[model samples]
Every structure is written in structure tokens, then in C-alpha cells.
Target: MIETPASIVADRKSVYGLRTYISLFSSAGIGCYGFKLEGFQCIASVELLEKRLKIQRYNNKCTLDSGYICGDMTQEETHNAILREYDLWHNAFGIKELDVLIATPPCQGMSVANHKKGNELKRNSLVVESITMVKRLKPRFFIFENVRAFLRSICTDVDGVDKSIESAIDSNLSGDYNILYKVVNFKDYGCPSSRTRTLVIGVRKDQLEVTPYDIFPDKQPEKTLRETIGHL
Candidate 1:
């Protein structure tokens, strides 16, 4: 059954000592809902569309009004807003650092489903923004999720050199983070649908107790769509 906002609020666990996260390109806030379920509190979320951001607000995705930001990631305004909000949230909790950064950049340009994939779309370069934020925020852990083609997709890096997304990530963050880039189907990870996605996960070097492999989901028996929703 679909959960309502009130139900979610009632069921919400106290996050006093839990990890904190901020999301970039958080469309409708569904993707980060999983993180909330995992006991992480959202410090802030950025979505370009006001309509989509409203949905996030309606769902109470972030505890503070300032936490829901509507702005373009490419702009300096958005970056500053994120930093300001993160600092306020971080200071309020007296946390040493942000625990996680979850980014799901627009994937239309890199998705195999896009038949018109020819020259790289401008949106593809948005991955660079995700990379830039990771470097700036230096979260203890970070996650990037997109279509399976994302790794091979080309994007201009911070240095303005064109490179595959995989190479860009490796060149920029490998030195500071123990990173893992992998493509896996969600069905293998216990999701109902057979959705394949590329996941890039990073653990800051100082966070030595755990590696990306330690946090990656273990494979599980696949579930069919019929089995998942047939009752409805």
C-alpha cells in the first residue's frame, strides 16, 4: 500500500543521532525516500522545478522550509543556497560533517531508452555538477545513480576537458575516496522491477572502517511485477 504523509510522519523514527544527507536534483523526493527509510534525515534537497519541489514539500521530505530549494544546479545561487542550508542544519545538530550526499542527475541524455542519442545533450554535463558538489561538500559518503549508460556517457569535467563520466569521477575523487562504480539490476537487489542502473558510491578516505562493497546491497531472489502488485 502507498504510504501517506501523515502515516510516514507518525512512523518516522527519531533522528537525533542518525546520519544526515542532502540531495541534488531531487525530483519529487521519491529517490531520497529510501534514505529516509534507512534512518537518514534530509538536511536539504534541490529541485529545479517548483511543481516538483512542491511535491517534496507535501511529502515533508525535509524538516525545514529552507531545506527545499528550487533552483538550477548550474547556477552559483543554488550552490550557495545548498551550502548555507547545509551549514545551518549541520550546526544545529553539532555534527562533525555531512554524512551522505545523494545525487540522481537527469539521465535522459545517457539513458539507452533515448532513441535520439547522438551528440551529447547539455543535460549530460549536469553530472559534472554532482561531481563538483561532492568535491566541495566532502561528505563522508556519496551516491550517484543513473541509467546504465551513465558511466560511458561523456561530460566535460571541472577542468573543461571532455571525458567519460567514469573517468571524470575516478580522476577527481579516487585519491580522496574509496570509490566503487557498478551496474546492477534492482531485481537482484530485491526490487520488484528489473530496472538496471549505474551506481557510483564513495567513502571518504578517513572513513576507513567501511568500504563501498561493505554498503552495497547483497543480491536477492528476484520478484515479478505480477507478484508485487497483482493484488491491487
Candidate 2:
């Protein structure tokens, strides 16, 4: 299960029994974070911009045509369209399972620099679009990534009650997923840059054995820019 994703485009001999992934807010398929890698087969991807979709297609070295959708994920039509895609797969494969959902919604609403003194912008609530998809698709695991400020950003729920973004996710997904999150500096993981962000993961309660702590990668020795990219 720790294997890197073998190309799903290859014969089933390589990717058989692997998890299926659907990416939301996917931009050019490069910032997939980790969902489109080994052990996971990216079955579908959605982006708001058509240009990004083209970039994704052009840069796609991985297998699978990657069913792509261009639309606002927060809309009902988008949800219905994705559901229809899943329905078609189920009818053809005889099993209904979308193993993982990864979403990195726009961070303007939750960025610390955006509002130094005011409440978090309502725009941050777009994460709820992903939460709704989880409720509908019932994926075994979900990945939510955003700026570190997302942990403190607040939003209004259907009841109009003020809630932190974390609370909103918990309120929506805790029923099925045991959510966990950590603020990580990717540089510690050997990335050349010092990009820090909040990574939230949800493992379905039934999959308790794969805890949140287990999902994140261990910190590797730091690599300086010279060692990482000086040659370039």
C-alpha cells in the first residue's frame, strides 16, 4: 500500500486493486500534492479554468485519460455531473467506490495577509464544496489542503452560526471520517523551498487503522537550494 502509483493506463496487472482518486480544484494537475501518485489511480479531475485543464492534459505523463471537468465545484450541476460519471463507471465495473478525494480550494479567504483584523472572508467556505462531495461519494479518505490560516478562518453554516473552518469540516465530515491535520513546512521534507501549509486528512472511521498521523510523510533531512537546484 505504500507503493508509488503505477500508471493506471498500463494493464490492470500493475494497478489492480489500487485506490481510485478524484481531484478537485486541480490546477494543471501538477499541484495534486500526493493523490495522483503511486498506489492511487487518478480517475477524474476538475478545474475551474479551461486553460488549466489543457495544461494538465499536456503535462500528463501518467496513464488514464483522466476524466476532466471544467466547472465550479460548488454548484449542483457540477456535483450531478461528477455523480453521473461515477454512475457510469459503476455500471461498467459493477462496484461503486471512489477511494479518495483531494481538494485544495482557493485560499484567498483564509490567507493571513488577506484580513489582518477582520473575520475570515466567506470565500474560504468553498471547502464545503469538497465536504459535500465526500458526503455524496463516500470516499474512504479525503485530503484537504490550504494556507495555515485555514485553521483559524471562520465561516457561516446553514444555520447561520459562526464556525471556524475546521469546525465546519468536522460538522460536515466527522460523522464518517476521523479528521486530522498538521501545519507542515515542506522544506523539512526535503523540498527545496520553504512553503508551509495546513494539510488536513480524513480517514473513514472504518479505516481506523490508517490514522492521520500515519498518513503524513516523515520529515527528511533538509536540502539547501544549492544542493537541490544550484546546477539548474
Candidate 3:
């Protein structure tokens, strides 16, 4: 069953409820903050570095009901591990209903700074793995993020077929997903730094498509660096 925002707020008023989430490159679980504040609880996450996962557990007070997988996301083992968790959820009568899946595959290969080696950097193709996982999981919502350079970068795949990153993503994730993306700067949302990124959101056709502006409504009263850092 698809959950509308009203139902989510109504049902999760007392507890975070069972809206599931899985984050890739979870990075100490910080990315879930906004969603968590809105009452979505993470069920699992994957991060490559053990130190980061340990820090995540520490920050969450070691009380998370979520599972964390620390491993190279490009590897099949990582995929299988996540699948097993989902299967367990289903067997436990949880419906395996993943409300959201957010990922930030490593961006180094797509960064212009890495062009010193030409854009065919091996890690550039790792995004295909994330796309493949989305195909398998069929989450209600998914967002893939990376450096802004990712939007125009071209790189060869494992099959030696060179394609634009956007094309590759479309080809790989073709289906009910309505893909939306924009180059957005966090400063517009009162962030202290002018961090810009390419954020791609994929919603199943049945789900309402949302934009960066829809996500961050308070872009004005325009924050100044002085206001942001005055305490520190």
C-alpha cells in the first residue's frame, strides 16, 4: 500500500512506525536526519568503511533496530547481504515495504579533479551497481547523489560501451520510475557552504514526483556565513 504524507504523519505520531529505509554510503547515519525528523526509521544501511559504521552506531547510541553492512558496494556480497535482510523482513511479516532507498555512490571518479586520469576511471562505473540494486529492490523512492560533474561525464562501462552517465542511468533503470534531477546548491537552503551536487530522485510512477525546492522550502531569510559560523 502506498502511504500518503497525511497517513504517515497520523500513524507515526507516537512512534516512528515501520516505514523502512536503506541508505548506501550511509556515512555515520547523518543522511537520515531529515527523514528521521519526519518519522521514517531506517531498517538498514551500507557503508564501505568500518570506522564510519562504528561511528554511526556510536552516534545512534547503539540502539538502532537497523542493520549496517560494511563492505565494498560494488561487490556481489554486499548486494546479497542487503537482499537477505529484506527477505528476513518479509518472512517476519513486515511486507518488505521499503519506503526509501538513498545512495551516494563514490563521486571521486566523476569529479573534474579526477580528470587527470581521463574520465574512464574504474570507479566511475560503480554507479551501475547502485542502479542494479534499485532494479532489484524496487523501492518506492530512491535518490542517487554525486558531484555536479557527474551530470555531463562520459565513461565506458564494463562492456566497453561509452555512454553519458545520464543515459546509462536511464537505460539501466527503465520502468515505472519517474526520474528527476537538478543541480542544487545547499547555500540556497541556509547551509553554511556553497556545496553543489547533482541529485537524482527516482519515484515509482504511482508516487508523486518531488523537487529540490519541494524538499527544502525555507531557502530564504538567506543565511549568511556570519550567522552560520558565529557560534564556532
Q: Could you tell me the C-alpha RMSD of candidate 1 in Å? A: 4.9
Candidate 1, residue 190: Cα displacement in angstroms equals 2.0
TM-score of each: 0.89, 0.84, 0.80
Residues 1-232, model 3: lDDT tens digits: 3233354356455565667677887777775656666656555688888888887777552113346788888789989988877776556534547778888877777776665665465677777777778888998888888899886677555456878778877777646687877887878877777788888887776666663335433565557788978889
The number of clashing residue pairs in each candidate reads: 0, 3, 0
Candidate 1 residues 1-232, lDDT tens each?
2232342254334545556799999999988798877767788899999999999888888867788999999999999999998787556555568889999999988877888876765688898899999999999999999999999988988998988989999999999999999999999977898899999999999987999999998899998888778899
Q: Which portions of model 3 show Cα errors greater than 4 Å?
A: 1-17, 61-66, 114-120, 155-160, 208-220, 224-232
Candidate achieving the largest TM-score:
1
Query: Over the full model, what C-alpha lDDT does candidate 1 score relative to the true structure?
Result: 0.86
Candidate 1 colliding pairs: none
lDDT, candidate 2, 1-232, per-residue tens: 1232344334245536545778888888876735555656666788899898888778662234536788898788888877866675566443458788889888877775665545445677777788788888998889988888877787765456778888888888888888887898889998888888999999898985797778777899989889987899
Worst 10 residues of 1 by lDDT: 1-10
**What TM-score does model 1 achieve against the real structure?**
0.89
Report the lDDT of model 2 for residue 116: 58
Q: How well does candidate 2 match the true structure in TM-score terms? A: 0.84
